[model samples]
Structures are given as structure tokens and as C-alpha cells.
Target: MSIFNLIVALGAVTHKDSDHERVLIKRIKAGDNKALEELYELYKSLLFGMIISIVKKREEAEDVLQEVFMRIWEKAHTFDENRGNVYSWIVTLTRNKAIDRIRSKGYKTQEKASTSVDEPEFSLEGDKFDPLETTIFSDRAELVKKALEEIPEKQREVIKVAYFGGMTQSEISEHLDIPLGTVKTRTRQGLIKLKNILEDHISRNG
Candidate 1:
């Protein structure tokens, strides 16, 4: 086909993607075998791009891509749109699975790691979060920093001296030429205020 005809054909398929994806997801959730074909058609390129980007070897990428789609097929029921958009979920899963594979096998041949069990790092994922879960961590960190900035200059300085500078309240009092009791009170209040602001911010977000 000519370039124009190819573009027209792609446009037609592009327009159908949203509906196609929704249907595929529903069918996959319902345990339809053919839905796997839809998934391959939908995300093979994206998963391959992610695998190639990370593994950086054609054969390795292909191997990782297979693992990724297999997990996607098995975990179709875990695809929650409320957590994130479809693209983000797939990309996160693909990238993470590839990285986990590489780290396990030292990025050697594709056969070195074949879905092992009992990883120490797996349990650490309780506090561990991906960029896919929520951008809230970084956003709240910035906001807390800015909110700390909103506090009185002296309070901010004292809190920084105590928290970031690893100084005790008495040390802050000596350094800032303030009474020890005053330093302690300021430190306590600064923490309380920051905690309140953080809680309020989290509530607003959720």
C-alpha cells in the first residue's frame, strides 16, 4: 500500500483501540482463551519496547517480553483501572519484571532465571512502591518542604537543626542562643504542625 493508504489504515485501527482494549480486558477477566490474542495484538509492541530498552539485547528482550505477556495473561484479574491507566500498569509490570529478571540472573542468558521463588527483596516491597502506584510520595515531599518553608524562619531553622542536621534540642538551643526549653517546644510544635499538614494533604489527595 502507498504511505497515504497505510496512514488511513492505521488511523482506523487507532480509533478502535479503546473499545478493543475494554472488550479484551472483560473477556480476559471472564477467562476467554481468545482474549490472549487481543492482548498480544494490543501490547506486544509496547512490551517489546520496554524489554528492549531495559535488557538491550534482541534475544533477551524477546525472552523478557514473553515472560511479561505471560504474567499479564495470568494476572488479568489484577488489572485495576482505579490504580492507574492501562498503559502505566502494563509498562510498570513489564519494566519491573524485566529488571527483576536481570537482577536475578546478572543479565546473562535468558535461561539463567526461570521464575524462581523465595526472593529476599520481594518482602521488602511492603514499603517499596513503584512510580506507577502514585506520584504522591514525591509530590507530598515537595509540599512538606514548602510547608516547612511556610513556618517561621526560626522554627524552620530549629527543626532543620534538629532533624536534618542531627542536633538535639539542647544543641539547637546552644547553637541558636535560645533557651533549651524554648528549643524543645519549638521542635515539638514544628513536628506537630508538619504532621498535621501532611495528614491533611494526604486526605485531600485520597
Candidate 2:
């Protein structure tokens, strides 16, 4: 079956038999590799799409998808149904792992450098800055600063280093001596929080 078909089938099965999911997890925890495979087969595409959304790279997303399943295999015993459903747990884990991979020093540095190299040539002398553009930029910067102030201090710090300092995610990780994965998570979460704050601010003020 196609991946989409598989996802739909799995969704139907999970929705129809939540108990079946719990049983699968229980079996997986009890050292059933087959159960783990079953879980992977069910969720791989959904998880892969999520990873691709965060990482924006197919190859890296694929790598992260593999790592996510590996994590699921090793950490299945830690899954607690009391806290959340299995689908939620797996999706969260997949997203977190993909964010971690993209936030790595190596991946960030390579991506940033490649992006910089791919831009078309532009001369400052040939293209003079417009006053309107400057004012708009300034306004946006102020709004962003205000939004940043609302998030936690650590997230604000990472966001500033990333967006203002023009540093790659990996660079931020190295400069702070923080783990690459931690940097990635912070960056992703911080940006999401910032976006929400900005949207709310705009809605109220606009």
C-alpha cells in the first residue's frame, strides 16, 4: 500500500481500537521487535512529514525519522499512557528529534553557509535603501524586540543570537557550549512562541 494509504489505515485502526495501541506499546516494551516495527510502519510517514517541516531538508528529515524510531525502540518502556496517548507521544518525540538534528552545529553551519553562497549578486551602490523601507524595517525590528521580551529569558537569548547576530544554530550552540540538540529545541520552541505572541499583538493592535 502507498504511504498515505498506510497512514489512513493506521489512523482508522488507532481511532477504532485505542486499546490496540496500548497493547502494541505493551508488547513493544516487553521486547517485541515486531510490535516496534508495526508502530514504525504505522507512523513513519506522518512523522517524516513533521520532521521535514521542521528541518526543511529531506535527507536530514529521513535521518531524523530513523533516529526517532530507534528512540522509540529503545525507550518504549518509558511510554506512559497515563500522561498522553501513544500517537501524541510518538509525534512529539519525532518533532523534537528532527529539531535537534537541524539545530546541530554541523547542520546549521553547512546550511547557513550554503544559503549565503547561493544568493544572487547585489551592489549597495546600485541599489540605494529607500526611506520607507528603512522605517518599515525599524518598525518590524521594534515589534520583534517587544515580542522577544515576552518569551523566557533563555529562549530570548537564543533567538537574538540566531536572528540578530546572524549566527547559525550550530554557532549559537558552540558559543554557549550548549548541546546542539538543546539549541535546536530552544530555537524551534522560541520561534513558535514568538510567532504566536506577535500574531496576538498584531490582532489586538491592528
Candidate 3:
């Protein structure tokens, strides 16, 4: 699957492992390190892929991935199922951390010193993805493609820049010449529409 497709597919299959992940997070909240490991195993590929897409460096991506889980282990208590599902929460968390890493001075200096600006850091053209992650994204991309196309173009633009382009809201605002609040509004609205579409798809598929 294309990185674009997989990034968009991040939370599109909310029903697949919802219950089991929720149980894992609950256990994690209650001080179960093993549950955290289980959660890490369950999501590492998908999350790491997303992080590498943002940071564009394998080593930095790996460090950010570790920091991401540490944050999860520390803040698992803050996960609110009433607001969103576990998948979306963790995806957002991973994306935010990745963005933060790229914005750091250390990352900027390292990036400036690197001579591989022309080379791709991560590629899905080979056996880079775990077979199961590939399958999950492939199955959901078909389901999400049409629904994603149905949203307003403006909302879709911001969503694409935020997710696939790995740009934060402030950066997106600057890039698109829109106010930061407008960018946030469009992103939230687009995601709400997408979430509703996925939930409807889940019900019908069942």
C-alpha cells in the first residue's frame, strides 16, 4: 500500500481489535507492564511506519517510537474511550511525538548534516511492512477510499497535509496561508465526518 493510503487508513478499521485493545489499555492503566508490551507489539509496525514517514530517519523514528510508548505507559490513565477509540488516540499521540522530534534542534541539525536528502528513508516497495500490517491497510483502504472522497475538498486538503504530509497545525496554517484555528477546525470537521463514515461502514459490513 502507498504511504498515503496507509496513513489515511490509520483509524479507519476501528472495529477490528477494539475490545481487545481497550482491555489492554485498561490493564496498562492498572500498572501492568506486560499489557504495555502487548499493546506495543500490537501497534509498533503501524505506529513506526507512521513515525518514520514523519521523521524520515530510521534511527530517529526508532527513538521517537520508544518515547511514544513511554508516554503511553505514563499517560495511559488519560485515555478516554468516550472521546475516541484506542487506535485513534495512539495514532494521534504517535504523530504528535514524531512531529515534536522533527521540530527539535537536534533533529534539525542532524537533518542538515545528512547528505541523503535525495534518498528515501523508508520505503514500502520492499518487504518493509509486516505482512499483517500490509493486509490491514489494504483491506481498509478499499473501504475508506470512497468515503474519504465524499468529504469537502477543503477539509480533505487540510487532513492530507496534517496526516500524510506530517505537518502540524501551525505549520499547515503557514503552508496554506490560513489561520491556525481554521486549520484545526477543518481537520476536526474532516475527521468527524470520516469517523462517522467508518462507523456506518462497520455497521453495514457487520
Error of 2 at 136 (Å): 36
TM-score of model 2 relative to the true fold?
Answer: 0.50
The collision pairs in model 2 are 105-170
Per-residue lDDT tens digits for candidate 1, residues 90-123, read 6567767766665564664444555542222211
lDDT of 3: 0.73
Error of 2 at 132 (Å): 34
Model 2 worst lDDT run, 10 consecutive residues: 129-138
Q: Which residue pairs show collisions in model 1?
A: none
Give the C-alpha miss distance for residue 18 in model 3, angstroms. Answer: 3.4
Better of 2 and 3 by TM-score: 3
Residue clash pairs of candidate 3: none
Output the number of the TM-score-best candidate: 3
Count of backbone collisions in candidate 1: 0
Off by over 4 Å in 2: 1-17, 116-206
Weakest 10 consecutive residues of candidate 1 by summed lDDT: 129-138
Once fitted onto the true fold, the runs of candidate 3 whose alpha carbons sit more than 4 angstroms away are 1-17, 118-136, 142-161, 168-206
Best by lDDT: 3
Candidate 2 local lDDT, 1-206, one digit each (tens): 22122222333333443677889899999999899888887766556555554565667767898999889889998998886667657755775686577668998798877753222221122543221111112344356556667888988778656532335778889988999898888877877887777668667775
